[model samples]
Target: MSTDHGDRPVTGVRLQKVLAGAGVASRRVIEQYIVEGRIRVNGAVVTELGTRIDPEHDLVDVDGTAVQLDAGKRYVMLNKPTGVVSSMKDERGRPDLRRFTREWPERLYNVGRLDADTSGLLLLTNDGDLAHVLAHPSFGVTKVYIAKVDGRVSPQTIAALTRGITLEDGPIAADKARLRDSSHGSSLVELTLHSGRNRIVRRMMAAVGHPVTELVRRQFGPLRLGTLPSGHARELGKIELGALLTLARRDSPAEATPGEAREKTRDHGQHDDQENG
Candidate 1:
């Protein structure tokens, strides 16, 4: 199947595939609906497993309701505020990240999570592939946090954090750890880690005898929190998005050289302050 695109043949994708790509549901689940005689192609019931669909031309329906492939998936970063859950729908009926994005057309989900009390950079996206890449530990997407702890942290404590710490979930370590400020028996420390374990930052501080009083994520991978007002969101620009895709592709042996990688990192750092200052 193909669609005419200014004399170019753009291969047409199936309705079920398009729906899955839109983060609606898995192909298997969509197929189940088809088998139940709930799906139609161009107004005709399509129970055949191999039914092909041209999304641009065909009218597809599920359960007698029309289904159109959502155009242009949305990728947004939210500066989640305190007291708001980082969930799509909260069972407790409390405010959630969705409140900040209720007007958006595309459905979005948090890339990872942030505790209700921990406010900072939180990613919301309808792009499932990018979400998977950002959340997956294998990609080593670094998350940086600025934490205010109850007690002073010495060089030894910072060293311990950098070296490694043991927790019930298992051993964990920060890629970088340093004291940012020390005053009035309380200290602010910056921590960078690739692990997405729940409450890992607070737990790590507790393990080091300095329970955290406040926590705020400052950065996520190449994306930074910057001066985005609490509860506001902004779309990821093309350059940043490209950098992330390049980073993901770097896993392959044929990827860019280390020098190129460093240059990209340096460029990202230069703009970090502007984006999140």
Candidate 2:
């Protein structure tokens, strides 16, 4: 059995570090607050860099408000509708995601992006660390999209997509691709990709024969679109969160240890069932 060290001396941590650890803001932003005299320690404004404090003992405040050291992070999935821009702001005064999230208590930003004409599952979070992880390409989070193409896609075009196609940016390949449905002249196809390039799905299809007339993301890693109504937002449940964390951890450069690998294997089976069901 491993021995636990119950009594350990506290270590001094940088004031900015503590604020960042609490998810208040990034370390650089905290420094800006310090330089702006917006940060205080023990009721005295501290404008000095390299200021250190013991989180358990120090009384820290920002802008005259006591800093809560343990703020719970939040993750939300929003079904973004067409016509709303994905960005935080637009000079043209077009509708944006903020209109939908203005009622939320926490400030959140979009994870990845969907074009203004596209619609589907979009992630919003106040947890910067988690957002950074999910947005990083190295994490290899798969985004599954259902694309409605302008024309029928032949088997040869699908094969080219799976084999990888050359675009103006570079060579790109879909992890998985299959025709969801084909009727009349238009076709619906599902494409899964790990890369988050700008307008990747549409460009990839266009590189072949079928240009996408419409696109909607159906899944992101373990999170599925589910029958959740369009233009609605919901928080991810604990089970879904756990599964996504596991998937993210697996895709991390820090390869899963044997124990983690086994856990992921079991979780993968359940995730597949849930996603397909």
lDDT of each: 0.71, 0.72
Off by over 4 Å in 2: 1-71, 253-277
Question: Can you write out model 2's per-residue Cα lDDT over 197-216, one digit (the tens) per residue?
Answer: 77888889888878888888
Instruction: For candidate 1, give the lDDT of residue 153.
Output: 96
Candidate RMSDs in order: 15.5, 15.2
lDDT of 1: 0.71
For model 2, the local distance difference test gives 0.72
> How close is every model to the real structure, measured as TM-score?
0.65, 0.66
Residue pairs in candidate 1 whose N, alpha carbon or C atoms collide under 3 angstroms: 226-276
Which residue pairs does candidate 2 place in steric collision? none
Write candidate 1's Cα lDDT for 78-125 as tens digits: 898888876777678988776877778877777777878889998777
